[model samples]
Target: MVDFFYSNQLRYRISRHLLYWLSFNLFLAFIWGSTGESYQIHLTVQALLWPARIFVVYGTLYVLIPKFFLKRNLFVFGISYIIWLLLVTIFVQRTVWQYSRSFFFPDWKNYDMFNVTEIMGNVFDLNLAAVFPLVFVFVKFYNAEQKKYLTLEREQYKSELNQLRNQIHPHFLFNTLNNLYSLILKKSDEAEDALIRLSGLMRYMLYEANVPKVPLSKEIEYLRNYIDLEKLRLNASNTIHFTSSMNKDQEIAPFILMPFVENAFKHGISNDKVSTIEISIIANKDLLTMTVYNTKKINANQDNGEKTGVGLVNVQKRLELLYKDNYEMIRNETESHYKMELTLNLI
Candidate 1:
């Protein structure tokens, strides 16, 4: 009952009433056909009879089939027809019996006067005439609504995923350029090496990163190149210590782990502080875990109010949508350090 109301079964109710009224009017016409005299009197009788007929027929349908019975289509149709048959039997018998009792109950000879089959045929004719058209209309409308809704939802999801993917490209390019600028300032011979690495990174971003997924080994190689470039920039100051370990034989979504590493190197290391950044990745047949930790300056600049960097915040949103309950991300910060650990259950 609650589901019916919440589903707003107004159309169903209207169909039921329409079917019942049509059936009742046909039955009333059939009854009146057997009597020709006093047409006005018979029409008045039909007007009164229709209300009771509708109440009994549609009321039984509403209660038994929708509210009480199993609600299967075959069961509802079969039982409703059986109920209508019984009601018609009683109506025909009472009408004939009343007429006989009035005149010659004791002397009646021919008892098989009325045709029962014709009456039952008329009842079925009325029911099918109303049911078929309404069933067609309802099914057509329902299917169209379902298709439109699914199409809209699919387009919305595609748009959102595209926006998120666009964000990754610019963020990555910005960080790589920053690292290149740092190398040029010190006139290091490794600046040539940095350019070579940057070209490889650009090739990967243009070709491989556009794919939905890439081998874990390829992504790890990308990260290693990025780390080496950063290393060349910090060689003069010697303030950044970076360590990395990974699985060389597994696969993962491309670029999934880069933002955390980028954030650590961006916020954790400085020109004046001796800082350490450690990254580790372990992958098995069913799971992958990546952890990154970086040391913070004792008197780090505190004016910026951003907790996780913008790149990491974007990564978090993507993780929530893509992995849902299949992943866990933990981020913690204290007066001395910042840490992030992400675990993904891969299919």
Candidate 2:
């Protein structure tokens, strides 16, 4: 209903204005006729007076308000308004009312042209008629300002999201390249296969993942490829467990889950000690849940804001921006392991 009134369509504007004027005229007729006067005569008089009332209302709304009042030219606006009110009251409203009364009651004495009381009454009536329509003018100004603010906010969000995503791209690539270089230095045959998988990952990042959302199946495939790349560099002491279940098709913000899995692999593995990394994903209807757990060397400073790299922090910010109240995340640490669990609503 609010949208209907504020709509910019010509037909809607015409209908809304017509309805307001009709209601205003009927109200005036009712008020005047209640004092034992003929209702039809009062209605006709109000109808004849519409031309002057419309001129006063529209001139104030479109010209006086915009040109002087909104510009803060208070002295000019006051002078112009008073002049407009007197002219309309004397030349237009008084002439219309006296002629209308004369037509209705030929026996009644006509009001004098310069009578002070009659001029003041016409001025009051004109101001009263303009009051309700003036409310609409302010309403339109407020709506325009609100729309402009929201547009700026949306643009800022897009720019920040893009910056965060760009930061992740180079960070992930640097880590993967380091792994690939290590394999090549060892004369490992796995280097060739890792390069191929890396090419596919880069393709997805550059193209498919650039959008706001991607199919859950495609994201899962990307994760699998990433895990395979990491597996090439893993030793016998490292153990990884990955599991997933999905009952229906879904779309999710791209790369939202990758940082957790990447963090697990980067910090979990140990050369001399047994290392274990576990990952799980489950999707049902509009909900998705993920868990990543990895064993890491215990340190006293881990809980004291020690640097844990950029991936986790970047992902946390992205989650807040994209999902806000629709997602929940929990982190836990113990003597030997770090775990993160995320629950997201796809809808």
Candidate 3:
């Protein structure tokens, strides 16, 4: 009784109610059509033989359908169901025959009505009545299975998304911590400010990014904070620029754009020569477009071993799961520069 209150259990019980009542009532009606012109007698007969009807109907639906037919043993399944039908018919007919003989057909010996031929004649109709609701039962099971499958798929997607989201945090922290270390080593005055920016970045990632979506305005602010931090690492010889225009009300996946910006800084910085990084974001109506380009340093192609930005790989997977075919991305890399352009159709 307590277990039935569980959600899945409750749903299963509710789902079976229709099959149970409909099969019972329909089988009772089929029995009613074959009786003689005595209402009380027929009612008594119905009450008595219902157990046998239940045995055959439920047996065929549960036992035969699953154990035999659904398992691809059709030859044995057909024979088994036919045998069950015949046995139930024989049992009911014998009981009715005995009762009617004792009361209405007393001393009318050697009656033709109780013979095997008469019993065999009704097999087709009995099987037809029994098989009628099998269609509904199969359909209900199919629908239930489909619902279960979809639920599992949704859960799996959420799990994968959470994992990909988790992957972004450590990669981000590693880069920021390295920057902080360099600032401290050089005894740069910007070290304290960089630490403060790192604090803000951590706060946003910890709280805001835990959700599936965040306001596009907040994301851009976060991006700007990161760019400001990176700018601190540059000297007079380097240039970094960011420009964005979007309504504050629009929402987007958290940290979705951070990887491109981070990659631009990672590969485009140098003390040997002047370098520049360009970043742009434009969102209007339901469309979002972003472009990032950075001039690669001479010998910047260090086998950093981390060729694929974990964040970029993570975002691409997330886009596939969240947007499917609704998003487009372009990449152009030349000997001197690399550019990434992303377009998204927002909901």
TM-score of each: 0.59, 0.75, 0.73
Q: Rate the local accuracy (lDDT) of all candidates.
A: 0.67, 0.84, 0.80
Residue by residue across 176-226, what tens digits does model 1's lDDT show?
888788778878777888899999999997898777677777888898898
How far does residue 130 in candidate 1 sit from its true spot (Å)?
Answer: 5.2
Q: Pick the candidate with the highest lDDT.
A: 2
Per-prediction backbone clash count = 1, 0, 0
Candidate 2 ranges with C-alpha deviation above 4 Å: 1-23, 38-56, 67-124, 298-309
Worst 10 residues of 1 by lDDT: 125-134
Cα displacement (Å) at residue 230, model 3: 1.4
* Decreasing TM-score order of the candidates: 2, 3, 1
| Candidate with the greatest TM-score versus the true structure | 2
Candidate 1 regions with alpha-carbon error over 4 angstroms = 1-143, 235-250, 298-308
The residue-level lDDT of candidate 2 at 68 comes to 92
Best of the two (2, 3) by TM-score: 2
